[model samples]
Target chain A: MLLALATASFRIESSFRAQFWFKLLSGVLNVIARVSIWQSVFLHGAGSTDISLPQMITYAILGATTFSTWDATQILREIGADIRSGNVVSHLMRPYSYPVSLYARQLGARAHEMLMIGLPVLVVMGSVYGFQLPASPGHAALFILSLLLSIFLLFTVSIAASMIGFWVMDMLALEWSLRGTLALFSGGLVPLWFYPDAVANTVLYLPFAWISFYPLAIYLGELDLLSSLLHLLYGLSWAVVSAVLVALMWRAACRRMIVQGG
Target chain B: MRQSLSLYLYLIRLQLRTRLQYRASLIIGWVAQAFGYASVYGAIWIVASRFEKLGGWVWPEIALMLGFHVLGYALGALFTLVQLRRMEELVRLGTYDTLLVRPVSPWAYLVFSGFNIEYGGHIALGIGMMVWALPQLGMDWSLLTVLQLVASLISAALLTGSILTMIAAMALVLTRSRYLFGIYFDFWELSRYPITIFAMPLQFVLLSVVPLGYMAYVPIAALLGKPVPVIGEAAPFTAILAGPFMVGVAILVWQSCQRRYQGAGG
Candidate 1:
């Protein structure tokens, strides 16, 4: 049933051919902007001697592609709308879990986007800026594991954020705050390596690190094999913790809905 | 023109009154917008502080550029946000016909009906940056310079409004063209930084093709005694013309597209 929902989502997304082109164009343009900013940074010889231009370029490419899979803002907005219109109540009537089914549908759309938009962006920008390969095959395999964990981690966090809509009427404000936090803390734009030691040390331990920092760090060979494995374990723990939190929040939200007769 | 101006103000007043009903959300949205923009620019600032400069732009100078970009965009968004964002909806619902049949000029009517007072946060942030950054730059604040700065800001607003209006015009011909705004925003992201950071070809595209440089970089550069791309010393003067030129172009495109807009069959 979930598979059917996902497939339907993929088909619905594919039908919007014109939107696909625009999305692809924007994705590609975004990578270009990122690359230009980094190029100028390195060209001017700013920052420390540790990180190189190639690594920053690769970070920007991956930041725009593989790691950019989900959009927390748009998803939260949808959830908020459902709550506002009392559409969420109907979901509870179904046998399947609402969050899981929503995830499945989003997964289908994201899969389509990654293939259709993400790959093109990666190839085009990667070729233009010379995208860096993984540190080694061992690291490459580890990066994939971390990437999967990050996806789950991000989804749980988003779900937890969405649960706020159960109480707050102002979802738009909530959405922006979530987006701001994600963009800054996720290391999706500037790598934590270049961050001040004080910030880098603190952010390295945060759950947001797994979203883009740790996976990209692992790929770039910033973390050795022993540390990569350790980081992946840490990321998994964060994801599990977030999942539990999301479940608790979901339960509370459902209770609130019933109490209010939504 | 005076009549249209008054009509626009009256319509905007109505929108403001309606919007005032949601006082709590309005304040919350404002705070969120301020925080959102702060983080977005904060990321760039982090990178800049680490590197000390970007394309020869120090953090202070970049702040000024950001000021212009945000202020101009906020001003433009006041008139064009509705058209740019909801054009597809209007086209989809066949509301274009309703707009056309109204006694007032549809252009003014459409522009003001969607008046976005939500950009108050952006305007405040923009002015704050400009005010904060100006003293740090040590640039002369002559009367002429001040006038030029004000004119340049107006030009930026016009250019931004025109660009969004042009994109919204596409909805008239192709109702599902909202995604083109994505392309515009992609460029907008690039504009937040120094254009000199981009390759020459991209810089050219930003200048002549899209004229985004006029939106912030060129005018700011000229004001700071930095060499303006291509035009050099005459950059600020040329920047003044950008608003009128783009407005003319946007009007032409909008008119032509509306003429071709057959109603979405009910």
Candidate 2:
């Protein structure tokens, strides 16, 4: 049954060709847009960017594909809305933890997205601009670990962001702000290596980097094995810290919900 | 026509007042929005300023491009983006049925009713950026150039509004299309940079089919006397004409879609 829930997203994708088109077109636009920005820099402003033009294209395509999976912002917005309207009570009374169940549901949904959207977009994009595979099997294994780690970190952030429903009347403002912060810090738009020295260094250490950037960087062989392993540990540490925060927030949210009982 | 205009204004004013009632949400939403935009342009600035110029555009010029992008979307947000965004919600709540029974055109009413005044702040912000960037870019703005700039902006907003209306109209019939509409912003993200950077095929699509040039690049190109590759400077003139033309087509489409409306709440 849980497996069916995971594959449910694929059902939606299969029902309508429109969703597939939308995701594909959007992903293509993302790559084109990123390439355009970088092409300008590398073609005319090459004196500045450390990453080669080809590398930037690879990064953009990979970065956009991250959304082919269940995005944190969507999960955060849905959960926030559920909590706000006390729909969370339905889940709260269940045998399992609400967040845990959410994790289960979303993980399944993401699996569907991976097959229907993520892989197909990569194949299309890879054919167009070409994709860079891992340099070695070792790097390939490391990339997978980093990618999974990123998903874990993303969930932590999503949970923390969703907790704002305890206080805020609307989730749009909170979601918008969190997305902005995430896009910048997570290297969703531009890789951190291109940011100014202070920003690059600071953002690199933040949990956000693990969400998309570091994993893609690893796949590109941009990080050495030792550095990749070290960063993976660092990412795990951030996840642990974030999970603690999520627990505290969940407790507070429960208290708030009880006080504002519907 | 006058009656319709007044009714539209009245409806917009009503929305404005409603939005204002939720003052705290409005203020916080705008700040988040501003920060969202700031980070995008901030990163662009940091990277673009690293060199003398990018694809023949200086850092200050990039600022102006960013201004056009924000200002254009800000206009859309004020007039119809938020309303269009909520069209799907209306379907679920059966509120869309209320619009159908209204005396005015439901298409116009649905498009104009939700006036997000917060976008006004963003427009004002864009203007501030333009003021700061214009002087440094050292462009000698002639009267013709200024006229072209205004016309270009109108073209952009009209073009975008029309495209959105068409999408919304289709979504009204095919409810799933609404989710497709949500992803439409990614298309606009294409306009943040000059069109010259894209390959020939993409340049054709942006110029002819979708016409993103009118949104960001064509106006700047016309102002700076730079030629828009493939289509030339006259590409914006196409946008100017297409804008109102598309609106008419969208209305025609919306009317047909309404004929096919299943009256939500399955």
User: Each candidate's DockQ score against the native complex?
Assistant: 0.79, 0.59
Candidate 2 lDDT over A1-262, as tens digits, reads: 5555555744654676767677667766776777677776777674654566678777877777763222557876788778767788787777776666666667766666666676787788878887777767888899999988888888778778877767775677777777778877888777788777877888898888899889988888899988988988999999899988988988877777763444
What is the alpha-carbon lDDT for the whole of candidate 1? 0.85
Question: Chain A only: TM-score of every candidate?
Answer: 0.95, 0.90
Each model's TM-score? 0.96, 0.91
Candidate 1's docking class is medium
Q: What lDDT does each candidate get?
A: 0.85, 0.75
User: Per-residue error at B216 for model 2, in Å?
Assistant: 1.4
C-alpha-based local distance difference test score of model 2: 0.75
| DockQ top scorer | 1
> How far off is residue B35 in model 1, in Å?
1.4
The residue pairs in collision within model 1 are none
